[model samples]
Target: MGVVNVTQSQPVASMPEEDRKLSFREKVAATIGNMTGTMHNQIIATFLLFFYTDILEISPAYVAGLFLVARIIDAILVPVFGVFVDKVSTPWGKYVPYFAILGVPIAIFGWLTFTDFGLGANGNVIYVTATYLVYSILISIKYAPSNAVGPAITKRIDDRISMGQIGYIAIMLGALFASLAFQPLYKALGNGNDARGFSLIMGLVGLVGILVSIFQVTSLKERYINPNNSQKTPLKEMISAVFTNRSAVVLYIYVLALNLSNGIRTAIMIHYFKYFFNNEGLVVIYGAVSILPTFLGVMVSGPITRRFGIKINVLAASVVNVICMLSVMVIPDTKAGIIIFMALNAITAFFLGASTPAQGSMMPAAMDYTEWKTGKNVNGLMGSIQGFVQTLAMALAGSIAAWALHVVGYVPGVEQSSETIFGLKLLMGVLPAFVLLFTASILWFDISEEKQKQITKELAERRQQKS
Candidate 1:
């Protein structure tokens, strides 16, 4: 075992040897698989709270509490799933075997959440809560494995960067498709019953999620498994590793802030458009206008990260986002003003979206640091811990948004006071801007490109000697 090689700078991508480069097919398959996971997330984040509040007539407080409960359950379970992944090995692969087992359950539970099932208000809450827990647990089980694959697939930093870029592009595309399809699907299927529409849409999306998940499982190739290491990491040790790894800890805090902000923004957008603007249809238009620039962001993220370094790229993008969001907040609420503001928001999303790949690529490097320091490869633990933190942040945001809505005297399907409108504006703009500014400032990762290169070279040497 060697000492941990943590450094105090962002790691830039370096060209891998010829043998280490991933095939185009492999990259596509991973991207598609990642897209499926993100699609599920997009649906839940962007629409779930709105569905419960608006269509089902659930109080925002109840729904927010439900979110809180589910996330807490998930946060507790995340590390257990990580340990399980580390201990398990099978014919399929160490990381992906659970994918096949969890696929059907994930799909079934995901679709169930949107259904009414003739349950009364109290009964519906119970049903929704139970179903959400199941779906969240399944996601916990599956996401760590999928995320851990980048490190398992290759030791090459550039390959990891490439994979992260492709994976985030998949995420953007999935969110894009959801945004584009949601209004149309709800309109066509629900007619007057939006509840039914949402259920059917989720059903279709869930099935696609299952198929693409399976596709991702089959397509991925895990090349860096430690053959001699079959022992499961103890819970205590996993906890120790989490705090001990400075890079991982910093990332946890960073992602928590980012996701919390996103959760608030997404949970309130429909409300902002529907109640505040008095034009619910504008939600669709906003989604449509935002997609092009967001797509452009995903397209260019790889080149930008490679050239300017991930930390610089993310910092610059986030600074621009802060300005854009503040601009939106100050703009008057006219049709043209809103359109222009949405366009600017689109640019903000572009910069924000561009930061994702760089953020993701950092985790594998963190895992490398953990292993180099502790003599144990805890990639699953690292990934799941991040997932756990993100879930917690999202829960915090959801609950806060819900309570804020209540405090502002928001009533579903009714006219709101000026106070309510002001709160909605804060959720959409100022709150998120402040949180994002914090996100940019704290992204000073402690792993330089040079240090990462050294870590990788040493890890390879260690593995070779073991083999």
Candidate 2:
């Protein structure tokens, strides 16, 4: 018994040397799964409003309402689902089960959202509201759980960071496809009718997304702590833990700022393309340029996290973003000038992509901090608050964008006023830059990598003793 205890005590000299480094196949599978999941965001953030307003002819005010109301509903669902994820046990894993159950339905509803059926403006609004709300809820089901899985898959901070980078790469690829391909596909299929063409493209992409998620669930393994045997705490206790847990609160606030900034940029994209650029087709060009940096940044995220720490990386990215965004105010909006500005924005996105992995690493650290301090793994509720805050940010961003457009005298189907164009430019550039700067302040987190390893080592010993 003494020898066994000693053997267990020192499983390895240091972190077991990661005997099961992710193989190429596993990395590819993980990337595909992550990319599929991100289709939800890219589609929502980049395309949905434009699809409704310009293609379906829905009112901008109504579009804003749909975004706000649907997110509210989805936010309500997050805590409930988090509780469900905590209590449930499955063959695949707690988080993977959601992908199995919700992935198909999410895809189906997404398909319905794009189909349109040639409904008039009012009818289209009603159809879109119902389908989009359902889609949003379904997305919450998969997203909340999958996010928790990141920590569950690995105890090593470095491995988790690597996984996060792979996931970000996948997400960037999805964004790239959505931005670059959707418009061209719509043009080919709809023959100049954007509404029908875009719908068809979304339906096809939805099918692909479902398959990717399914494959992800089947291929991946959850090898770290099992939620089933982990310590359980009540919701109130978990909520309290989040406040006391400094890392958790900082991460929550940081995510809120990032989402708010990104959401503002997404909400105003159509207006910028149509009014400021004087061409709707420019949406594709901007989208491609903006997303390209994500691909470039993902390659270096692991090394950056290793060298500079997560908070510093995030701060550096935010600084770069602010500088690039402020340039828009100085640079004239000529074709060449716009392209140059877009290129600079893309560079900012590269750093933004690098920061995402850092953010992901922080969540698990927060979970560990809670467990280490309270002896309870309240990942589900912790994840719920994270989701809720992020969704709230999105809702606020959408409302702000809608109100900004209204204040600037934006009127659909008419040539936009110069004031409206100015508003769009601000929304595209300055607003997001300022929001990111503020969020960077919130990322004054204290969870260094070495400290995180100590927590994990202690937690593993505790688990072994109980066993």
Candidate 3:
């Protein structure tokens, strides 16, 4: 799984003469690059299913199958890719080159997924399978390495948190833009031929995202403490390292739960809006309300983390999210009721967004722990597990939504029954709330903020001594 490279051979502790700290501008540029990459992902994850089903007229079953297959492939490939990333020594550095080479293709595939070329059901399925596979692979390439790069860029705990805040703000904005634009863009492009237009717009967005990522690659510098750029570890050793790293395992479970909760929320949104509110346009309203809170939360996360700590913030936010989710169960779906739910949901979004930066920043700490404990750095492998967990959660959420629709006797492309409609309403609101409660419970196991700082300081001290 890993490749050996011809680079300076030294122990992980071999210290360079000087530590290169990134300038604030370089950090900001890096954050923007990371944000663009994540934004590209959010657009596809949030809207791709809806686009395929509603606009492209693909079958729910087929779409589900495609997601399942692609995810399975991704799960296997991600760890291997992680090893590959760890092994390679490039002029651009270990992890940044993937952004340059694969970023554009990733965006191109995103556009292709939204395009409707008048392909019949069978033809469309084939086209989607091929294109989607390419999209998944390219995304894996860019995502796994980019994730690994975050830690490589800086060893400063506070700086990493700050970088994560900037990245989170970017991600929230990207999500907000996609949420705000998808429906209007689809409509403006002409409902009949809008699929093509949507595809084009997404393609352009993807291209712009890639270019932004490239700017990050050129502008940001890696702060390598260990000057020894040695041959990559073997695949067997990498896998062993990943499995043995308890912190990585805990973080993986945490990420999986987070994704599951979020995925359920996303899958149920369309159903909730259409049936409960009796206004399809409420989708935009929902997006606006939810994202606004997230925007505010991301803005304050860095300072909050600095003051209170990541674990406490995450736990507090999870509790708030649970309250908000339960509130949705009590609120009806009428205009006034919807407003109340949206307000509560907005609060939930704020907490979730705020917690996300902390969680993301913690990942590098986990990677460092793995390296310290196991005498190896497997950032790519760790990130691959993260990617697998996230996509797996999305696949499960999609499947759950589809199956729920079928159980409630939801008929696509036709007028729905009252019972079916009622079921849809429940799925959108109550189901996600239940999932949130479960996620909140599991999140209690996370490491405290003080503990994280302790871990970071200890790892750095160890590296300093070894060097």
Candidate 4:
């Protein structure tokens, strides 16, 4: 609870002006942009694997192999995208212009990924793989800048937390829409043909994606620009700098574990509902039950972060989430048991949703810490590595889930054996519980709010001296 004393440091010879306050209109636009973007991404992560394996009858092993390869490529390209972002200077500034140029192509390819091209096994493989890779590349191109945009829009930690809350609302909205609507929409729209339904659904998502990019580029303004970003570092130097960031390293590891757990759980959820519950439609029911508590968690996250720093809040939420998940693992799968489990799931989802704002808030603070230590603000590089680690974790989860199902002799759309049922349950409940526990244990983040305050003060002093 110590107050950060910026005035103790030597005063600037002259202070010019304070950062401009973000308007409500801009905030709304930014929030919508994040909402739509996250919604589109959520659909891909949540439904695409099922679509590939179940609807299209593609070999899960083949799809899994492709997922692993694409992630490897993503790992390589993410940092390269980081370096590219750092080096480029445009009239719209470094981050915003990419949204304008790349948005359409990203949307189109994202749509194409879910479409049925009437391609046979070989043709389908090529079409799906090629389109997915291109969409991933475009997402990588935009993710760094899009993430960096939050910190750029505001420097005050409280303001950033408020923005984070808004963003989480967007996250929940996106997730809720995807979770509740995907099955029904596909059923109603596709009229029993899942491929066509998925295509139609994605076409709608694609249009929304384009509109989001337009809104973001047009309505948002970047107010905080790092003075150190003026000179571009070589890729080797950038990589070296990113690794040297201790807090960034910690955040990356934490994010990887978090996303990995979610990825595996998400990839297996439909199967669990279909086989274990004998009610495939229960997925939507669970989503419906989750909406209220999850929204409450997101709404309260900002105040909680303001009161007890983001690190503590995130850690506490993670621990609570683990406990809830453990309860889920032990609960029976009967009617009453399922109701209790869904209630617990709702509570756990709340904490998970609550932690998200803190998660987003941590990175920019880490970037500030990195700049304070290394005298270079590599937001693009930081964003890239964070994105890389997260994408890689999720990709790995999908690959592992696919392979795990294959190992257990899973046959889609058929009655599974007890062994396969146990495996699915393990994936859904037990393994993710362990992963969440591990995540909670390792989240010993050292970057406190007072430290961030000090960093912000020092960076401002440096910028004034430079000017």
Which is the leading candidate under TM-score? 4
Q: Give the higher-lDDT candidate: 2 or 3.
A: 2
Ranking by TM-score: 4, 1, 2, 3
**Candidate 1 — which residues are off by over 4 angstroms?**
1-19, 44-68, 111-132, 182-207, 227-232, 271-280, 406-424, 441-443
Q: Give the TM-score of candidate 2.
A: 0.82
Writing each residue's lDDT as its tens digit, candidate 1 over 161-219 gives: 67777787787677777666777887799888888988888889878867766776777
Off by over 4 Å in 2: 1-19, 27-31, 44-68, 112-131, 183-203, 226-232, 269-282, 334-336, 408-429
What is the per-residue lDDT of model 4 for residues 18-112, given as tens digits with 9 covering 90 to 100? Answer: 34556776766656656666776778767888988886778999987887677778788887777777767677777777777777788898889
User: Count of backbone clashes for each model?
Assistant: 1, 0, 0, 0
How high is the CA lDDT of each candidate model? 0.75, 0.74, 0.71, 0.76
- Candidate 3: C-alpha RMSD to true structure equals 5.4
Give model 3's TM-score versus the native structure. Answer: 0.81
Please identify which of the two predictions, 2 or 3, would achieve the higher TM-score against the true structure.
2
Query: lDDT at 150 for candidate 3?
Result: 75
What is the per-residue lDDT of model 3 for residues 1-467, given as tens digits with 9 covering 90 to 100?
Answer: 33322233343432442234567777777667555566667767777888789877889898888877787788778777767777666776777667677776777787787777878888988898898899877886565777787777776677777777778877766766666665677666655676766877776777786777678678866664343332456667877877776666767776776677777777777766776667777777777777677878887888888788777787788778766766665677577897787788788888877877887777787776666556677787777678777778877887888788888898765667878766775676567656655444434344455555454455555567665
> Between prediction 1 and prediction 4, which has the larger lDDT?
4
TM-scores for all candidates: the values are 0.83, 0.82, 0.81, 0.84
Instruction: List, residue by residue over 308-418, the lDDT tens digit for candidate 2.
Output: 887788788878878887776666757887678678878887898888877777888888777677665667777777878877897789888889888878898788777
